[model samples]
Target: MHYAPTWAADGDTRRRPPLVGDEREILTSYLEWHRATFELKCSGLPADRLSEQSVPPSGMSLHGLIRHLAGVERWWFHIQFAGEKVPMLHYSDEDPDQDFDDLSGDPAQALALWREQCEHSRGIVAAAPSLDATGIHAASGDPVSLRRVLVHLIAEYAQHNGHADLLRERIDGATGS
Candidate 1:
């Protein structure tokens, strides 16, 4: 069945971080909330509009963010934390910014991949015994803990969500991410 993306009210969909919780619970909740915020920013937009870049010289777009975050989710959760040997997605040393530069792919597909990555990340986190568990950092080849990964992903999403906020506003004057 074909489904059209729709945006619901913030309170209805967005999850607030728990007032009290363990460190892992708090961290994961914040990360998940930010992930939802990014998706919410892109909600209800058509494919063409999702690929619309900002004013010249700035290649930032909602579609680009979706692709970029998808790569990041896989990199940190699947490859780095879970030690999965998956091929890179929408990224390469030859074209480091391909995620933002290549707008040829369908936005719907990019969004779907991002959602899948998010689900995979959650599973990885759930299976992990403790936040102290360590994994290799893809770039530095240094050991990093699940806590670090969660924090980094949260910061990454926060930064990209800011970009998404501006991009969405530019696209159709929609505010609040």
Candidate 2:
């Protein structure tokens, strides 16, 4: 049975990124659009379906992607950008792929965490004086600008959205951007 995601935007609800806007507006809009797209792709499936590894030999699932994106948000925004001391999500150096590999939790909970991280990320961006605001890259010990992080995140979501699209299609033959 198909279940429409109550929280996520369908085609009608998802906002179109402004064709003309300030740099910050443009970037944030695109990021928000991509996030909604990811969520949209995950809509209309039961938890079992969401967590099912429909793509054979590939461990990716809509639920796993949600968990992975939550971890990405924490790693980039909370840890790197905001310099928050929050514990990493579904990760340890000993088990780097836990987010995608483990699918034992409620998909709702994972999506909730993903939403929380996204909100925090927006706050960090808002608090910054400009896109030039810098964060320390944990791995490189190098300065990374908010602009770079935003662009990188957009790319990350875009790449993952493609995966989401395929996974969604395979699970139920549903497809769209």
Candidate 3:
């Protein structure tokens, strides 16, 4: 049997005491906390449950959320940071909305893939010396720096994790701080 990557487990370790630091360190720490929080939101859920579309009118099951986020990380960190023209997995040119289309299925597999993507993203970010690392947004041809991507990624995860929290609670009445 396969296992989700341990790195994908999102727990409340983000609740650590605030740290006193320079601006860069503080921003980096904030991004890390959100990433961890996002992971915690889906922790311990079975494959079926993770893939279930808990919210109607939206294809955002826990599994789908994981996949979508992984894609986002790849877009911002890998493609943007490295300036590569990589193809998207669930996203397409015609119907770009398909990115969140089918998130309900194979919870373990989705989570594992998400973890792998996160690892790749983290490695790229870590190797960079400054957030000002340069890249271009493929869609807009707009300039995007590593710092901006980091902050945007953190915000994205934080928002989705909030949604995940509510969905998880609805599923099993399990809540985490």
Candidate 4:
């Protein structure tokens, strides 16, 4: 059977607005749009397809992408903003590439895990009082504002969503604008 692109809220449906607001709202709007884009990218994919590493050399799949982004979001929003070294999905000091390297498993399990991580990451972003709130940069020992992190996350998601678009096309001949 044919599958609708993940970005579609309903099967073949696309009613969601792309973005909303002014200059002050740009960061949040961009982040939300990217988040929606991520959801769209993952929308109609099967569990198996979602986890399949079609990009062999890169070993990047939609599920893996979600996992990696979740870890990234947690690092920035939770650890940095909240000042806590919370454990993250697919993260490890010994194997910095663990996220990409260790993705062999049931597709359903991986997808579920990714969904959970996304929800948690969203919560972190939502809990923050403002984008101006300060967060410590783990690498630089410098202060970074939540606003900066939000922008960075938006960029990251936008880039990955592009990859997702291509990957999905390769998988099933479905395409999105």
Candidate 5:
């Protein structure tokens, strides 16, 4: 089945990463690409479809993925890096999987939340002194650099985007980048 273009229309010069760039730029570029890919996977679908846990036996849905990513971005950047005293997003000791399990919220709102988190992440990255800047890992209480967080976030998006692909395909026969 046909799907909308995964990216912008032809000739639309997006803020794409160059073939060559500095370390920080390259990492951020790759991270941004994965972020866009995840969004692309979620586009052009209704709320009900986005909330559908297509792959049964695993309560994973596109809406859930969006929530999860938003939480992740906040955790890594605002909470972990910036050490903000903000409340956790979609998470708790009792309901750790709430982001992935709770599908009652509006999908549009979930997506908007994710976008906002992404914007915050971009701001955090842009304002940082350098990729080598250190942040404490909440769990381990050990120092973790901004570079490490960027790579981790990129990997997270890549893995979940794969899930989004399968979920989308199962919802409708649509597939591919």
Candidate 6:
């Protein structure tokens, strides 16, 4: 009898994390997958839909998510990790939640910024000689390792991707990672 191969579901174009390899390679690959998955969840959405607070009583929108993620990339990778003296994005002491609450600008601009931050993050990760390389925690006077930051980032994206999935389904009838 003939049998069909069980593959990842249709439209799943992301690379599978290495079956066996360096720890850094596996972690980074998984992170890239999560990032792409987040983007995929937001795909094909118009700016209006992207900006909709589809899940009512929550101020979260896809546009806001994009801005939030971009800020997170900078916050973790550049400011905390690379020790770049750059200002934080979408945030001030008075409005800590602006990243998720403010959706007033062009969403395309937010997306572009997200993409740029992602690229910058990739560069920082690549340049590091070891995952053991440490960055300072701005809130505390302790060091954080690149490995920990990468894992945390992957988790962050995965959690937000779940929110994105729900938002996309509510906006349209599409679903899946």
Candidate 3 colliding pairs, count: 3
CA lDDT of every candidate? 0.89, 0.87, 0.73, 0.71, 0.86, 0.87
TM-score of 6: 0.92
Model 2 per-residue lDDT tens digits across residues 1-177: 122233343454667787677898889888988998898888778878889888988988899999999989899987888788888888788988787898999998888889999998988999999999998988798988999999999999999999999999999999887
Cα lDDT tens digits, model 1, 1-177, are 112233476543876777677898889988978998898898888889999996457898999999999999999999999999999798889999999999999999999999999999899999999999999988899998999999999999999999999888888998875
Give the winner by TM-score: 1 or 2.
1
What lDDT score is found at residue 77 in candidate 4? 74
What's the C-alpha lDDT at position 169 in model 4? 79
Against the hidden reference, what TM-scores do the models get?
Answer: 0.92, 0.91, 0.83, 0.78, 0.90, 0.92
What number of backbone clashes does candidate 5 have, counting pairs of residues 3 or more apart or in separate chains? 0
Worst 10 residues of 4 by lDDT: 1-10
What would the C-alpha RMSD of candidate 1 be, to one decimal place? Answer: 5.1
Please write out the lDDT profile of model 6 over residues 77-139, one tens digit for every residue: 998889999999987789988987878899988999999999999999999999999999997
Model 5, runs deviating above 4 Å = 1-16
CA shift of 138, model 3, Å: 1.3
Alpha carbon lDDT of residue 66, candidate 4? 72
Off by over 4 Å in 1: 1-12
As for candidate 2, its clashing pairs are: none
- Which pairs clash (backbone N, Cα, C closer than 3 Å) in model 6? none
Candidate 4 per-residue C-alpha lDDT over 1-177 given as tens digits, one digit per residue, 9 for 90 to 100: 122233533453433333454433666656666776777778777777887777657677877777777787778777776677777667778877776667676656765666676577667667777767787888788999877887788889889888888877778876774
- Can you write out model 5's per-residue Cα lDDT over 63-133, one digit (the tens) per residue? 99999999999999999988888888898789988998888899999999999999998999999999999
Report model 1's TM-score to 2 decimal places: 0.92
